[model samples]
Target: MQSVALLLIGIQLVYAGKHSLQYFYTATSGLPNLPQFVSVGIVDGQPFTYYDSKIRRMTPRQDWMAKSVGEDYWERNTQASIGSEQAFINNINVVKDRFNQTGGVHTYQEMYGCEWDDETEEINGFDEDGFDGGDFTTLDYKEKRYISPVPQGLATAEKWNRDGSLQQRKNYLGTICVEWLKKYLEYGKSSLQKKVSPQVSVLQKDPSSPVTCHATGFYPSGVTITWMKNGREHHEDVEVGELLPNEDGTFQKTSSITVTPDEWKKNEYSCVVEHQGKSVTEDEIRSNKGDSVPIGIIVGALGAVVLLIIIVVAGYKVYQKKKGFKPVNGSDDGSNSSAHTVPQA
Candidate 1:
């Protein structure tokens, strides 16, 4: 029984892979730079930057099958042993047909195929993939069935299932549309791609001096601030504070750190502002307690010192060998310096 289940999963994965479903999976899974929903507005009369929610929240659909089946029905069948399987399968088919009719593919699978019995792969109900996973089943039921990694929040779950089908759908669709438009303005893609930005801010810092750092102009509501000391990340030193909203409907955030002057000189200090799983922007300024020389000068100085020491040691050894001195033999007078003697003595 389990073997067939594994086989089906393998086959679906292959189908997903052969047709490049992995890309869709990854695109949906939060790959940077690909594209995702974001927010946009004028902050202090200036343009706001992009934002991505790594895991988009789930919402109920306008035509959610669970709702159509009735809340009472859903709650009852949701926990039933064999009935749950039937209900789940039925929802899968409904979602499949809906997406097909709309000329779109929701989630990763082309069509969700549910099992009627453990042994035989049979047809059942289904739901749309792009919508919130919450709309479909109870939190425990979802964990047991969908195998989705999205965290289940009590706040979302409490009201999501109880709401009317149309209400849930409107709420779900509206928020997603708003997010989608925001992304359209920012990334110009429907889904967010996972990729790192090429631009890196160079920071100034003294190896031995301690300095304070802060950031302004962010949607303070959903952002976090952290410090990267000398390229090494230090999460412990982070101080997150309230996000001060701007007059134009945007937000601003600030983060700070204090370290000794010596640490700053040897290591770089970077202020990383993070939202979701990606770094929005990292502003860095550099200072040095030792000598404010170009990196090239530091490298050159170290190299010169090493070379000089090697040359001096090499010259002394060469001079001794040239004079035919015996290193281990003592002079006849027993002086400290070793002496050379002819083979005949």
Candidate 2:
């Protein structure tokens, strides 16, 4: 039995590391200032293409994406997004009516993507929809059906299933989506596969404030920031923040812990940041306030300044699917938002 369990564990490990390609679409109503429709294309958590109702054109966010694809690709995707914009606008209104919401700001979002495990070459896909900051429907790819979380989505789910859209979705998610993902990966391998170590720092306003451990300028997004007390893991009063994108295309995150000066003096508290298999920790900590300093160190005053400009452009794609807004650089039109493009699968 132990050998069988070990074999299972080993099998699971074969599919551990995965690369994903995803597209996010958001349609909004009742917000005159913001774009009514927005779409974004992402590969391995990096935004590559963006389109909004205001721009009315599909633009490449990454240099590799622009250099690899030609004008026809952009024209094709741009036209598709223009069509999807109208469709999604109708979808939002449909959802609003189903929910009996006559007015007020509402958003309808769709996210579909595929993931490929590098080691095992295993592929998996997902399609989900959200309405007004909540789940509406999700596709069960294995069963080839749509699952509705709310009563308002039941009709949409049944109609989609009855109209034979599931088979089309299944084909897209399994085959076409994976093919596009592979192509994108090939085009952007140099940038996508490159990993950069994070700059870790511990900061505090004064002896009374919570000590914050900030990790910034890391690539590939996956990271772990933890607090340790006396060499063991510390959990109490620790607040882990959301991952935010830096202007330089890297990612930043913060974890803070509240401890009294006396408690910190009595115990050895340290912040550890693990990114891309590298661990960073500082031992000497100093504060702006003239208090008895801790043994650990504080670094990156410059990073703290950069953090002030760090705006959360992309939403938590998996967690809070409603907030899918990203601003493109060098846009004078004052219209920055999120959107999507529909590819025939």
Top candidate on lDDT is: 2
TM-score of each predicted structure versus truth: 0.25, 0.80
The best candidate by TM-score is: 2
Worst 10 residues of 2 by lDDT: 5-14
Per-residue lDDT of model 2, residues 199-281, tens digit only: 76668888888888777788777566667787678899999987766778887789989988999779877666655534343
Worst 10 residues of 1 by lDDT: 305-314
Each candidate's lDDT (Cα)?
0.26, 0.64
Q: After superposition, how far is residue 208 of candidate 2 from its true place, in Å?
A: 1.5
Report per-prediction Cα RMSD to one decimal.
Answer: 32.4, 10.7
- Candidate 2 global lDDT: 0.64
TM-score of 1: 0.25
